[model samples]
Structures are given as structure tokens and as C-alpha cells.
Target: MPLATEMFEGHAINRSAAERRAATLTARRSVKKLHQAAWLVNAIRCIDLTTLAGDDTAARVRRLCAKALNPLAPHIKEGLGLGDMRLTTGAVCVYPTMVRHAAEALEGSGVPVASVATGFPAGLMPLDLRLAEIRYAVTEGADEIDIVITREHVLTGNWQALHDEISAMREACGKAHMKAILATGDLQTLRNVYAASMVAMQAGADFIKTSTGKEGVNATLPVSLVMIRALRDYGAATGYRIGFKPAGGMKAAKEALAWQILMKEELGREWLNPDLFRFGASSMLGDIERQLEHHVTGRYAASSRHAIA
Candidate 1:
């Protein structure tokens, strides 16, 4: 290809991206201008409370995080052995310290590890500290690092601050994939999630994970729906097929399946895999087992629950 031709192609690509973004905004607004959800689902998600039974108040809150896989490993392994049939390719994401636990628990099991960092649930710490945490986790064998955005800054409309944090975190990822968590519960609006998705993708986020699975309100179908749409729009502009993950409070098999169905319908079969899509679930694994077993076997097994780590 000629140098001028290459340059022209790049410009055309850039312009086309801008137009797509513009169209998305117009479409989103038009849809919202007339139709919007009158209510948010107040129905409680089936999150196992054991995660919340931590040392103190903060520890208890942190415990609400979905890293508790020790109890659910065998079911996951058995479910994987079922082969060629699953609602979706399932993987377990745990905290950094628990990576080895999850790794050993999932050995030969094929499920990947996604570690939380950037002072997850509270990005009030220094950027260097956050980046180092990300680096250390990857070094310790994390397949993915789920870093929360510096919401204090992003919410202030500091796009540059937001961009730089994501850029640096992405660099710290090394060989591991980077999943930028917007923690949409804290972001508080669809507009914020949409814009944060754009910023993270441009800054090199490998995947745009929706929450910390902290039960902090970040993971919702609608919130994930918005972020996925934004990621799709950005990919059309920048040629990066950014991934999407809705991690928190996704405990029921039906809920996870609904998300998967939406993902398949919107992003195509390519996003149906664990690479581009995942449920950061704690209690949903057993449900998946129940689902698969009931389908493959005649009767559901009472032993379908976690084999007790």
C-alpha cells in the first residue's frame, strides 16, 4: 500500500469512528427521550452471605466480593468435564492473595483467574500503589487484573486523570489481560458508564468489567448493556474488540443465562465465550451444575452443591 493511501485510510477510519459515536449518542438519547426504565429491580440477587461474614465491618463488606471459590471448585471442574456442553464457558475470578488458591483449586480445570486490584472498591490510593498492585498480581499468575477506576477523579469529569490511570494500569498488566472496572454502582448513571467505557478502551483496557462483584450495585443488566454498547461503538471506531464483564451480584443461573443470551444476541457468538464475557459469580456455580446436570442426567443430584472446599 502507498504511504498516502495508508494515511488516507487512517483518516477515513478516524472520521468513521466519530460518526459512529455520534450516532450512538443520538440513538441512546432518542431511546431515552421517550422510553426509560420506570423502576430498577429491587428483587435481591441470590448472593451467598458467607462472603460477607468477614473479620470486621470493612472486612465483612470486602467479603461480599465474589472470590470465594474454594467451596465451588469441584462442581466447576466436573461441569467442565461434561465437555462440548455448557451454558457458557465458566471461569472463577478471585482476589490477588487467593490467586494461588483459585489456581490450585482450578488446576487442570481450565477456569481462569481474574484478580482485583487498584485498591479495589476504593480507588482513593496513589496511582503508583495501584499500578504496582496490578503488576504484582500478574507476576503471581493472574490471568486477568480487574482494576477499579479512580472514581473520585472520573466523577469530577477529569477525563485526563481517568485516561492516565487506565493507561498506566494497562501497562502494568504485563502478559495478563486488563479488565477496567467502572464500578458502575458508584458511577451512578448510564452516561457515566458510557463515557468511562470509551475512556478505558482508548487507554488500553483489554476488557471493560462492570463491577467489583462487591454487591455495590455496579453489575446490572442495564448498566452492562450500556457499557457493552459503548465498547461495541468504540471497537467500530478504534478497531479494538474490547471485552465486557458484569461481575457483581450475578448469583442465579437464570440471571447469568439471561446476560449470556443478551451477549450472544448483541455481540454475536464470539462474545459468548469466557474471553469476552464472564460472570463474576460466587453462588451461581452450583446453579450452573444444577442446570447442566438436570439437562444431561434424568434427575437432579442432591450432591450438586459445592463439594465443600
Candidate 2:
């Protein structure tokens, strides 16, 4: 698809209405009992279980891959009356250096390997080096590349620069899908988030991510709502549906439900799948498993029994 340069030519966001709608969403809908359980299961499917750390090793990546493949043990699946359902996370995310380790470990598991690249957590590197990092991750068998945009471009009102930079990163990804992380917390305003989201999709980002999980303020309801609306408008204009990922600070199962509700309410039921929506989460899975266990046994399971790593 060609870039939708015209779509974001004069984009603007209504911050107050966005925040009010975000607040109203939670108050309007409540999923409980079997509905909540089912949503939690869906959350499991849409989780890009992540392990990005300094001490990450081959052993740790392998263990994380194992957990991704069998997020819900057979007993847990049976307990939920989903004996026929073989649930797994959407993908396993690791650093660029660990992409190969994750790829080899997750072989035959049907989970794509996602790698954080372009000097992730702080995209302050030169454009050439950042693009090279994306290609290297793709070569290492990463099925998805999560690249952080140059926040300076958005900060300085340089939409063209941001679009060109992300376009280059998307091209570097080649066959692998590219996810543009907006790091909304650092963008200063909801308008910046909206503009950044539009520029990323216009530049061919397969998904627009909320944060890098390292920022002081990661994903939040209001930020996510603004981005999702941008996605909706972009989809309407270009007819190319983009995906959304809300990362950071979303740990509990209830938080997962809140995001799911937001997606279902804002974008409709079609956005509930792993292809369209994903939670860039690590510890969130542990809490989801605990909740699932409680749903089955009518009691909470020990945290040890549902360890993610």
C-alpha cells in the first residue's frame, strides 16, 4: 500500500474527549464470570510474552519460548473446559542479540519471534545504524521487528522526517512485519501520539505500539484510545487495517480485560485477535494463568504453579 500522506496532512486530536471516552468505556462495560474468563483466554492468545533484560541468555530465551508454547498446561486447559483448545501466546519478544536463540527455541511452536531493535528503550541512534539493526534482527529469524521512532521528530513537529525514517525502517524489515513503538509517555501530548501513530501507519508500520516498557509512563487508557482512533481513521482512509499493541504497566488480568474491552468497543470484534491486537507483556501472563486456574478450581492457584519463566 502506498503511504497515506494526505491522511495526516492536518491531523489533530481532541484530548479531553479522548480521555472522557476512555473513562466512560470502563464504566459502561463490565465482563464477569464466564465472559471475563473467555476474555482472559483471548488475552492469552494475544500476548507477545516478552523478556528483554540485560541478563538474558540462551537458557533464559529457551525457557521463555517453552512457556510461550504451552502457556496453559494440559491440566489447566482441561480445568477451564477448554480441553480441545491448545492456547499459546501471540509471540515471544527478545532483544536483537537474542533473536536467533528465540527463533531456534520456538521452532515448530507457530509463535513468531519478535525482537526490539533500533536502539530500543531509547531510540537515540543514527538512522543508518538503526536501520542496520532492523535488518540484522530479520536475518536472525525474527518474524517481527519492533522499532522505536525518533522522538525528536515528533517533538520538533517534523512529520516528514518521522515518516521517512520509519519508511526506511519498514523497508529494512523486508518480509518481517515492523512494529513502530511510539513511546507515548515521552511524546508530551495526546496530539503527538495521534500524529506519530498516523505517520507510522502511513510509513508502513504493521502495528503501532504504545511504549517500550522502560519509560516512566508506559501504556495508559487515554493514550491507547487516541492511538486506536488514529488507527481507525487511517484504516478508513487507506483501507489497510493496522494492528495495535499496548505495552508496559499492564500486569494484572483485570488490566488485560480493560484493554480487551477498549479494543472490542473502539475497533469492534475483529480487532480481538492476535493478528490485530497484542499485549506486549511478560508478567501479565502469570496473573492471567492464575485467574484461569481460579476460574476452573473456584480457588486461586499458588503463584509458583503459574510462573512465566
Candidate 3:
């Protein structure tokens, strides 16, 4: 669809109400024992296990890929009766230069390699340079490209500019899927978050991401509620189901359950799939693995035992 400001313009988001609703999502729906294990397993499938640091290396990316291939330890998998389940993370995300390493390592495993491109973490570069970065990532064998949107466009109410920028980046992605990072923390208000989300989806973003993890705040439930509502409204209008990712500041098994619960309640069970939802996390996997191990052994394992990379 084209840029449609009418969909989100003047849309009112009550922060207090959103916060109240988000709070209940976790408190009211509590899974225990086997059900909890099942949800955690499902969460593993929706995780975009990521490594996007300034000092990221090919070796580090390879190790990360290895973890994605076999997230749970053999003992934990066996204890849980997951015999040859072939569980793997939804994808492995990395810097553009590290895409080749992840692509080669995850080849034949049915796992996609996602690259954070278009001047990721802060898309402050020239549009041409950003588009070129996307092309480079695609040429490097990235199946998905995570592009960051310019916060200024949202802050200054430049919907046309924001839409045009993301649309061009989407074009540059070619055959690869594009996840537009809204960087909602910098957008100030929940209204801005909703508007940016609508514009990103209108510009053909396969997924609308909450943050880049470098902001002062990232992936709060209230902000996520606004984005999820925008996603629901867009689906209603266009009949197109878009994905959602809440990146950064999510580092616990409980947080994973909360977000999954949010998706299940707000968007139906269909959104629980990796194709529609994902957690952009690195260390969160460790916590999830730790919790699973405890569920199996009845004793909490040392955090080192579940180290991701």
C-alpha cells in the first residue's frame, strides 16, 4: 500500500489506558509447569537471536549461529522429551559485514540470516548510502534486512519523508524481507509511535520493530501496545498481516512470556509465529535456557551453563 496518513493521523493513544492494559497482559495470564514449558519453547522459535555490537567479529557471529542451530543443550532437550525436535531460533541477526559468516554457517539449516543495515542503530546517514547498505547486505546473503528509520522524520511530523525513506529501503532489499525499526523511544509520544508504525507498514515493512536498543528507553510495554494496536488497525484496513518485533531491554524468560502473551491476546494465536512476531534478543536466550533447564532438573543451573556465545 502507499503512504496513507489518513489511517493514523490524529489517532489518539491514551498512555494511561495502554499502560493499564499492558500491565494486565502479564499478570492475568500465567502459565505453569508443562504449559509454561510449551510457551517457552514457542518463544524460542520466535526469537531473532542477535549480535549487533561495534566489536562484532566473524568468529563471534559463527558462534552465535551455532547457538541458533541448537539453542537448548542436549540434556535439556532430552529431559524435556524433545527427541530430535530440531528446534532452532527464528533467525540470526548481525551487522551487514557479518551476514556472510552467518549465512555460510546457517546454510542448509533452514534458518534465515538477518542483517541490520541502512545505517542501523541510528539511521542518520544519507538515503543513498543507506540504500546501498541494504543492497550490500542482500548481496552478502542476508534473507532479512532490519533498517532503522530516521527519528527526525517522526519527531518533526514528516510522514511523507519517513514513508519515502522506508519505501526506498524496502526497494533496496530486493528479494529480502525488510523490518523497519521505528526507534519509538526517541519519538516521544505514543501517538508518534502509532503514526510511525502506520507509515512503516504503509511503506511495505514486513515487520515493525520497536527500537534499536541504543536509545535511552526501549521496548516498553506501553509503547508496544500502541504499535500492536496500529498493526491490528492496519491489518483491518489492508487485510495484510505484518510482523512485530520488540527489540532491546528484553532479557528475561518472564519478559518473553509477557510479550508472547501480549501477541496471543491482542493479535490472536497466528501472530505467535516467527513469521509474524520475533524478539530481537541475544542474552534473553540464556535466561530462557536457564529456566527450561530448571524446569527439567528441578534445580537452577549456573548462568554460565546457558551462555549464548
Tens digits of per-residue lDDT, candidate 2, 3-53, equal 455666566677798889989988999998888889999999999999999
In model 3, the Cα lDDT at residue 134 comes to 93
Model 2 has an lDDT value of 0.91
Instruction: Estimate the TM-score of every prediction.
Output: 0.70, 0.97, 0.99
Model 1, residue 305: distance off in Å is 5.2
Query: Lowest lDDT 10-mer window, candidate 3?
Result: 300-309
Top lDDT hit: 3
Tens-digit lDDT string for candidate 1 (1-309): 001112111221233443455344423432111111100010112122222112323333233323332322344335435233322234445556666655565456444566788887777788899888888787766777888898766577677778777888888998888888888888865667777777888888888878776645757666766777787777776677987877777666566556655565567867865556656655565554555455444456685343421
Question: Sorted by TM-score, highest first, which candidate order results?
Answer: 3, 2, 1
Per-model clash counts, in order, read 3, 0, 0
lDDT of each: 0.59, 0.91, 0.93
Point out the higher-scoring one by TM-score: 2 or 3.
3
User: Which residue segments of model 3 deviate by more than 4 Å?
Assistant: none
- lDDT, residue 198, candidate 3: 95
Q: What is the C-alpha lDDT profile of model 3 across 1-309, one tens digit per residue?
A: 778789998789888999999998898999999999999999999999999888999989999999999999999999999977989999999999999999999999999999998888888899999999999999999999999999999999999999999889989999999999999889999999999999999999999999999999999998999999999999999899999999998999999999999999999999999999999999899989999999999999887667556
lDDT of 1 at 273: 55
